[model samples]
Target: MPKPPGKPRPNSRPYTPQRLLSLAVHHEVRRKTQALSAFKDAEDQRPPPEPQLPADAQAQRHEPAAYARRLAMPHEQSWGGISPFAKDYARIVHSSAFRRLQGKTQLIPAGENEVFRTRLTHSLEVADIASRIASTLNHGSGAALGGYRINNDIVACASLLHDLGHPPFGHSGEEVLNERMRDYGGFEGNAQTLRIVTSLESRLGLIEDRAAAEFAIAQAEERPRGMNLTAGTLAAVLKYPYQLGATGRKAGRGAVAGKGIYEEEMPVLHALQALGLGLSPQRRTLECQIMDIADDIAYSAYDLEDTLEAGIVTPLDLVAPDDDLLEAIRSEEGVRACLGPLAGDMHRANTRIVDALTQVFASLFDLGDAYPQIQTDSVEGNRARHIFVARTYLESVMHARHPMVRRQFLEALIERHIAAITLVADADAPHFSRVSVEPGSRLRIECLKAFNYHRVINSRRLKMYHYRSRKILGELFDTLFDNAMERDPKIRGLLLPDRMHEQFRAQGRSQRREAARLVADHLSSLTDSEALRLHAQLTSGQSATFNTYWR
Candidate 1:
């Protein structure tokens, strides 16, 4: 039986910045130690077998069906006539984690305006774009994808689930969580995403149960298996395929700094690699590359639309080159270097799109006068104008008449070259393939990203919200971490939901560290509003009739 909860721990030690940083480092070391112990135990039990694919099998035709092998989950294997990859689609669509994205942030705060994208909407758009890209590659020139057929379903699932680990309050919340977890192996949205899909999510029960049963192990010892998705889909979702901590690979170009799976998740990574499915350990798969590019396109195109609708920026602002802003953008070394040769073409393209969009906006606001007014104050009016701008912009690029269009096409062609999957000719173990992007499009996308980063994300208005979010999250982490270590029943109950609290208590001697991580995970899972409400409750002792907890 578990000990009952009790009062909060004494606040003798103030949570100084230095103290928190020290604590974070301490926890990270502890996590790595525990992980090392586990790794040693697993290694002692059995040496990992060599990958079983034949040398000739390495050269087999790279088709979609061949790569869509399901994991050895009983439920996953029994999906009656449904395509193996399609099960991945269904599993992701029906997941609670995926649904929670609706309440999570995208660019602006969710519910600020119905028209603004939430993580959920962004994910759906990414899925659509990824699928379209895959379909285009599948049918439009097989030579473009290096003779390997693109798997639309795999790409779609990967795209839809890419942002599953983003916490409430967007990147702000993620930053806070990472700081809090610094000692506990550090938190990352992508790494957390892998954890969610493999262990935390309860939808599919334990993936190891099938193996445990074969060994006649007791049911009580079973662990969670996550969604038990197919190997191909899982590979596509791994934007960074390294592990966390010192033992992990160094961050390379296009990879997030120190981003990878948690130490506990190495088994899952190894299991996926062991399937003989031709996945490389170092590089992303071709489908992953497509999903990544689609993500870039959707984010650049749609987030700009959201900014326009919010009136924070305008189509005219993007079109009309502000010399100061242009100089600032070009001053960046990479931008200057990449845009050097393309300057003439980019300028001409920008001029045409801006001029065309200006006319479209004018027509929308033309209330029968020689001159047009910018009628974007009204919600309906703004939405109408946004639609016109988006359509015109998309059409302009699709027609490929503008210089930007030609550059974009050339850039994509270059991406195909870099993203080509090449099987190792003689390696005993399967190695991953490298993915790259053209310098021009990469720089252009960076500039577009910077436009949002500077114009909207760092604008005076949103900074206020971001600052407040940092405070709320910081206080929430401190309060929960303090109480979570207490032996008191009431404090423990308040710190987490019953299920989570029970799990924390069950850790016994390691409850303190486990409690801190559980708190971080719990906080990361909250919606924006939920985080705000809980902060109010914990900080100000405010009482509300509504339930603020989210699973």
Candidate 2:
């Protein structure tokens, strides 16, 4: 009996190593080498390799794998469409864009605390948490998706690659880059992540092969770069399904409203939805839900962890007020203002955050696979109440809401700390601002995000740091470009020092974007100390002079 026309085959085999290797080699030969070098670097540093089966286990490894197996296979079976999820995952994991995250800051500066996380670590944690949530949800005994074959690979890959598009210096860098590129429609990390996965990740022939040459020719007449993934994966990776201006908000909507996929990526996104969601322009899929929940779980807990490790506010600091301070300020107004009276209150507030999270974990674990529909409406209501309740405690007594509190503990500990350290701003800015639950939520989130910017990011220290960094990167680019200018003698060639300059130069007018991208790529790959040192050397200008140890 033949399978129905539209449905996938019941069992499809995983792509053989020979097939995958062939695909990889073909793509490698065609790729711009510099970009491929960065991709290879990332591939080289993937935690540790997953265990491989012995030669005798080939039969077991070759068993048919399905759900979205065709998308993962190196060889094409029928037409052009490959799974979007697979492409997104591969794009994120393999691209230079993802590797640059390691050098980027998260909360504090990259060099601040050894244990404190950078953006790369934070993203990895988020991916892990998201993967767990998706796995539990998919495998859970919930009626929501009982009979469907949930792809674990899709969830894991999507979750891991989600943050690949963040710029340097964490949110601060993101803002500056967005402001700089506003004409390019302003960069959002999430939107950039989408762009990288769908379009920019294919510098090498990783997608183009002898088998795919004809397809590439057709596409070359269109867009040069694309992941060419299945629609299902693309839709799943998209948390916001609408474009920036596509929808009007209904009355009483919350922060979730006005969220949609970016307008620029619509063609690819729409193509993905049409295939995966089985809806034209209107509907979303189950995988999107998993991605969303995973994101939330990761953001809340990971931020808290980063805060703790940085020692900004401790469990003890929140719970206990200073007795000496209270005694010193004895007037009624002074006493009222003193935090000594709020020690117990802070303790309770901290407990609430822990309790709510504990409940979520318990609900996840105890439900033992039957947890997805466990009266989550009521549970979610309770969770929301707790979130507000805990926040209120911080607001009322301990003033734990201050950005300084969190910054103190961050590796980069932005300007919020400098103000506290310098006593420049009233220490209460972090406390005075309530978490806004406004429409678009961007403004409110920006407030928390902005505090970091106004204080630390734009602070003289960080600016100096960036200025120095830009100088070093600029010099490196100059040296490389000068070499190219002198040696290659190309008229009107750009001067960026990337591994792939030759290929970029070959492209002619498209060279500027490629140049900037290369610069971004090189700078993004440096560690904080490495960048600073390099900058120092570049500015020194002499050849290993008295002050000339590698910038």
Candidate 3:
């Protein structure tokens, strides 16, 4: 029988070695019980607030119906009702694009370690963090977000779908693809995410009629307008609203020239504008701002988590003053800009946090060296160690008010200089917003990024792998482009599945650019392992096996 809460266990053993163990266990239990009792006593001493609507419920009441309206489709008429935003969430969650994120890299490749985040896990984390930020903004003490209540579902869907466009091997692969398709409105992951959610993902199943599906298909023959997500959800995902070629035209300050929507995706962009999400040539919505920030937060926090678990960098290393790392941070253009006047503050805060973390880690692990070696061999042990390190670091940062103030200063710099939302006069483009990170935080993030950049990405060990991956992609791209130019059926078969091949063929000679785009898309869609396998098959002149062909 189980003992009642806070009840002492009856003594049953004599004072032997086994009895000593039992007493130790009982003493630990008693300590926990006393701690719980103290917690309860403290809670009982505090006065309770007057009962009212839960914060979330209050916030939901202010959310407008227009924000929930679906694009090109009516809400489902079911006894078991669901919000249109919920439908968007369901659709994205069910998408092949979303599922494929599991196989894609974050900082490190997936399957490198059990605790390391992949694009899928990272997306989920981003979604969670984005939703939290939205909820906080909506219900927290801040002034009612200037009459705009962020929808949590919309933010969540946007966050979850944000990295859907990232190809295999992560940003390296993205850079390679972007180079290959430079003429064809270069590949941007954010833009690809927009494409996936708006046009590439199918939503015909919701139409409930053959005619509607055909009409939808006919309206956009080259690429299908995907999930047909609500305007609010779509708006939240449009980190960059302008087309690729229009980068230089009246772009706002701090706006990225290279990252924007593809030319073909403009129709859907216009559709979103028509729905009153107020998309300009270069602006993103508040929800998008929140999601983007959430992404930053997650990446900044988790990347360190991943590196630590992999034993590539130690907490002690970060805390310790390495001239090389400091020089790298100082040299970064973005960091330099932010730390212009606040360089001293940044250094002080950075050093303080690092020192605090080093002390915490040293105390926990009883460090002998300046940089302690972390456990990474066993997955469970690595995870446990990572958790301890992460918790200690976070708690240290949070408690150290100076660092927090410096961080806030950095955030303020971003808000003041980098992030901007302008009210525009054009009826077609009502609101323009740009999201940017301030230099201080950006510098800190860049430094953290540089840790991986110097140690892992550009290291002798990984450089060889990157070089080989690049070669494989380059070769594949050249061969496929040649075949696409010749209109070879085998190449077409390799480029796309049967249904998509028919669509590609339907375009004829005019679709050469489209064919090239298709090749890039096919290459980008492959997992790292899949890309390697296909590369092997192509290079060796071996007939593709079931594993290589099926995906």
Candidate 4:
């Protein structure tokens, strides 16, 4: 299917009123006072002192009635779909998925950088940027696309919750978990976020009878509950909506690699389609386009920045011309023969890619009511003109030689190093290999992505850490399972709760696997020091000395 109406040009198009209107209602907010009445009634009808709070903290905050009032009164883009925006807001803000992001790593592990971003902090920044971009477009005053406005709430919520489903240990953790869970459908961070908002987050009884339907949990454990969020928000969250089964691409192909939502969550994914916005399968709405772009912008820029600040990469190394090395390699007749005519294109493509990203950042936040009018009359045409200027500006400064270039450039080098190392003779292997400069277009992009991920992400030190952490996790799981399996009855009581025990006994193998997973989850959630201390105590019989204070 084609895109939704009123598609803004990426990063540079003027914001129209319709875009603003879409932003306003995209998530469809409901008043907590109204929606929670039912949840509250449900809570009150039960006994006192429930383990959960009287109301869901996140849910209560996005009440639709209050949102409606806000829209009715004022804000950007007074459009047709503010309700959907509200729905998205509530689903995201109140969900456990959002909370878990606090624990997930952004650059370093969560514990190492409390002040720096975790995934949650990153998401909030993306949402803020996306909303501002959408708002800028919608704030246009006139008959020109008057009703078109981006729903800021939906954008905010979508951006915030985008990383909600990422497993612990950042990308490395995701890799390990995805490999382990492939049979259940491969794990992708984006897909997990979808699952969490729709299902996994625990929701206790709190709303009233009438309001219950609004926030009713999906009956099936595998399905998405009605975050009761708008279709627009849901659509925007899905950067890739096609499931692995449906995607025609091969298993490890980059496109299909991250394709599907978990099978269990299919029902809720379908429900979002059925009940909320009427988007076609595997397609995104216009609002989703904005959100997705915003995500990319944030991912590329912020992650790069973090890698630099950590003293991992230097910008100077990236920008400095490789003329001497190129000349030396060319003079070596064997190396020259191997490189052939491919060297120039390789350099050019790499340069273009970096230039493209730089341009995106320079122009991204340049628009808005507050910024000065910097208009350009381009003989080449508007979009082309914008893109050229952006690329030029970004290439100039982002790659400019500076004292801290190492901070910036180290990531790319790491990626390149990984790319070079992973190449094996096998074509269909599970692992990726580096490409030489001679690869075709499709293969080249694949190489670039692989190289990028390897250098910046899978550094040796980081991989070593992942290996160590995985070992720690294995030890923790073995300890938990060996001790608790028909041994410590009290611990068994917790693991095999009344409702969970019969199911456990019936599917013994599955139960064992799930028990291991639960233990792994608990282990991954620990801070670095927590994991180390716990491991030491478990092995050496050391006690936590601070327990006396509690006593």
Candidate 5:
């Protein structure tokens, strides 16, 4: 879906035109009221309250309507008995930020080809997996799960919104953004996602009832309130519970993100804790854990399917692995746990890997099941028969059949893991219980992830793409950074888009950290192709670009 001329792109939740227009002063008012924080010690920006929410936070887990938003807009609350989480799901589904995901990369550059999945498709798939997990929990757990059902809408919405902050070029882009914004509260995709829904989307409750506009004004909030998701959905979307501010930065994949919420969102964080986002096991909601595992399952299994469909890796290639592949697998912590201490002997590990993978494929695919006669022959003959049949009908049947096979393969993989999920009560934790997969399923997921990473993502071809992507993002940041620092308004305005220009205006020179973050936010919001196209237009004199093409 094309982004609306501009929207958080969370769908409308029924604010009247009078109210939306009345709240138009929100952004301006926010700039005046709240000073954007400098890149200071993160603790200085933290809420004064205790580290965790109240002990009774779990008490409200069953009440979806009681979920809190950044701003309390009671007018938006009365959805005719509809749970607020359902509205959040709708808000996300129709959101601009969510739709922009179609243009963002998942693994490969988005919009370059139809075959590779983009962030949007991946999110939708995750949502599908997540909803299933939610249903399984709701039914399987029944009333035994603290007498309250897991909210399916909250889980699905969290899944859909989980990747909202992933910028173009995937993880590499994330790295660059984090480095550039290191002092500016840092840039982790998840944190940026939180920012998008809470601040960037800039939505207010549709004005139909109550003094919603007055409520926001009373709080001195003039900026958009994002999707104003229920505290339940907010907790679910917050897979990471800590801050990724200046002092808290880590060095690896999880390093930059820290807890996945920025210092800029301290108020939102405090609101969540106050609203009873139960504090336990790192503040992860059951829905959040469900979303996290669903993400892992999809990332591990579906990416391999994409690799196969793209002809990047053949099944035979996986069957006969290379030394590098085995080495990669050997180094993974999860794979090591799953395969045991093959230690330095990767050759033996390779054999085990091949055997295990073959077994997996045999159990999951088993192409010969459709042609029972072929199975009656020698195994080699049966394999040959399947190949011959595929080659013969390569155009008519095989081409169409491959997608079916891939789809079925994916479904089987999802089922394998999803079926293993169980609702286990966390007696020591705050929430009633959490959804967990068996240890065996987790090990298998890790092994699949290792295989996909080493074979597909770790390929030299992808490295080259990433290297170039890094360059493009870095250069774009550099140019934009300079433009932002320009003493002359004309030169500054030349490169920056209208939206970014407005942001720069709201930010003061004293808020240099804020300026850096503004640039990072601008860059992070772009799609893969837009990043490339934008790089060219911003860097060169010859290329002319327009926002209409991208925005």
Candidate 6:
């Protein structure tokens, strides 16, 4: 070891391995030398386009993977030539990975209560909102988009496909995978989404054609193009334009933090950028921006409905929430950006945020005009009210109106967001349009979105679930990863699914990154119930024999 040229400062801190590892977390090149959980999800947290190689530099031998045009196994080019984006839409919705979203968590875990929105339902809502936003802009500001119209089908595909890569158990499950893959390329939902679409999709045709399946098995080292989507649709689905190992990434914070792409997929992204959007890495496609905001809008409005119905939160709670809660909401990741300069002014920010949210929250319930005013603030006062049978009966009717009132409120909120969406032309990127939400509308959206944080995401109630997610994913990753690392196909084969085991064996012992990725893909594909059942079988030797219906 050598000292620096500069004189050492008297107050300089000692460089322990932990201290160096902590700092190296931000430096991608240096962090590769160390393997620790602390380096988990180190990111710049910027939504799109980190510094990228010149468009030409990214051309890959795997260029055919981006579209259906030049695949070893080609699928239909168009869905009956219905629309330019129609084929991609069919590919997305038809993928088994997309269907598995029904079993994945969105805000709440799936199967807890069938009424709550799973990732599938949330994606559907986001697609609807994104399509509506596209339509709104097309009708209102189409002329402003420099003659290029926003396509509803593209936005729908992008929105529906966005969450396909999310691991089971929601973000907590994602965090666990990210931690396990810290020394690998790092795990992120978006990056995994790309991986799924490009390589890991379970093709149904292969199962029926034994010869095709054997051919796939023989060529396991050469990754298959999953859906073989058009370059334009691929570009539209990329919410974040950066990859994990980009030279520009640095540790930072956001509401959500994870990799956008892996090194394996960068060449495809580069080729797509050259062929499709051609915008700088700093900018996203017009449709991608619409899908991104639609995701936010869906999360903000729909999750609130779920929470209120579950009794985890109430309309009154948002109308007049605690000052601490308001501050906490404003403090959430990516939320301060919605506030502009007002973010720094805590007093003004809280007041304005609450004022905006109140109007939206206040409409979620209705006291029927026929019902006498009831005291709901206190149980004792409510007990006195119950003694008045007329009042009790009227209170039931008033509360009954909430089911319909909330539906109308939900409709109104979705409509408000759609109307506020407009295309703002960017001078820096005239080739593209920037999707802008009216500032006030954006503020209200952020304020509502933050509730998922205050009452659900960051709440103590989910601690056990988080703990379970970490335990299950950690052990699952290690079991599969260690099996692959040992250079024994039989050992890896027993633990991993047949496809992943072969993928790992094909990579051999030298391609540790590829091997680890196979493990990750296998784990990430498991639905919540599958993960739980697999965990039980792997750890306790007990199985869900009665419920394994296909057997």
Task: For each candidate in turn, give its C-alpha RMSD to the true structure in angstroms.
Answer: 13.7, 17.0, 21.0, 17.5, 8.9, 16.0
- The segments of candidate 2 whose C-alpha lies over 4 angstroms from its true place after superposition are 1-75, 78-96, 111-114, 139-141, 203-229, 242-264, 276-284, 317-493, 497-551
lDDT of 4 by residue, 132-245 (tens): 555654553112333333457766877887777665667766666556555545566777666655544543222222212222222222233435444456666766665645
lDDT of 5 at 255: 31
Query: lDDT, candidate 1, residue 95?
Result: 89
Tens-place lDDT digits, model 6, residues 440-491: 8888888888877776776676767778888988898887677777855567
Candidate 1 Cα misplacement greater than 4 A, ranges: 1-77, 143-147, 205-221, 245-255, 277-282, 319-440, 544-546
The whole-model lDDT of each prediction reads: 0.62, 0.44, 0.61, 0.47, 0.69, 0.68
Model 5 C-alpha lDDT versus the unseen true structure = 0.69
Per-model clash counts, in order, read 12, 30, 7, 72, 14, 1
The list of candidate 4 runs beyond 4 A from truth reads 1-84, 87-91, 94-96, 140-146, 204-206, 210-228, 249-255, 276-282, 321-344, 351-452, 473-551
Cα error of candidate 3 at position 455, Å? 4.1
Candidate 4 residue 231 Cα shift, in angstroms, is 3.6
Alpha-carbon deviation at 416 in model 2, angstroms: 30
Report the C-alpha lDDT of model 1 over 342-441, residue by residue, as the tens digit.
5456565344333432332333333334212226467776776677666655644333334453345334533443343232222221223333455544
Task: Report how far residue 504 has shifted in candidate 4, in Å.
Answer: 3.4
Model 2 Cα lDDT, one tens digit per residue, 1-551: 11112222246333344554555565556553533322121112112122233445333221112223222123233323434345446656666666666777766677676666676777676666546544554354233332343455566666666666665556545555444334434446676667666665553233222323323333432454545444445555666555543445521122233344455677765554344344322333444444554454344444554544444533333233244322222222312232235423645433332332233222212322433333356977567656654654444234234445344433232212112111011122211111112221222122223223333445465676666544554555555434343434363333333324555556654434444444443444455555556555655763434432221
Query: After aligning candidate 6 to the native by TM-score, how far in Å is the CA of 400 from where it should be?
Result: 9.7
Candidate with the greatest lDDT versus the true structure: 5
Candidate 6 lDDT:
0.68
Residue 294, model 3, lDDT: 76
TM-score of 5: 0.78
- Model 3's lDDT to the true fold? 0.61
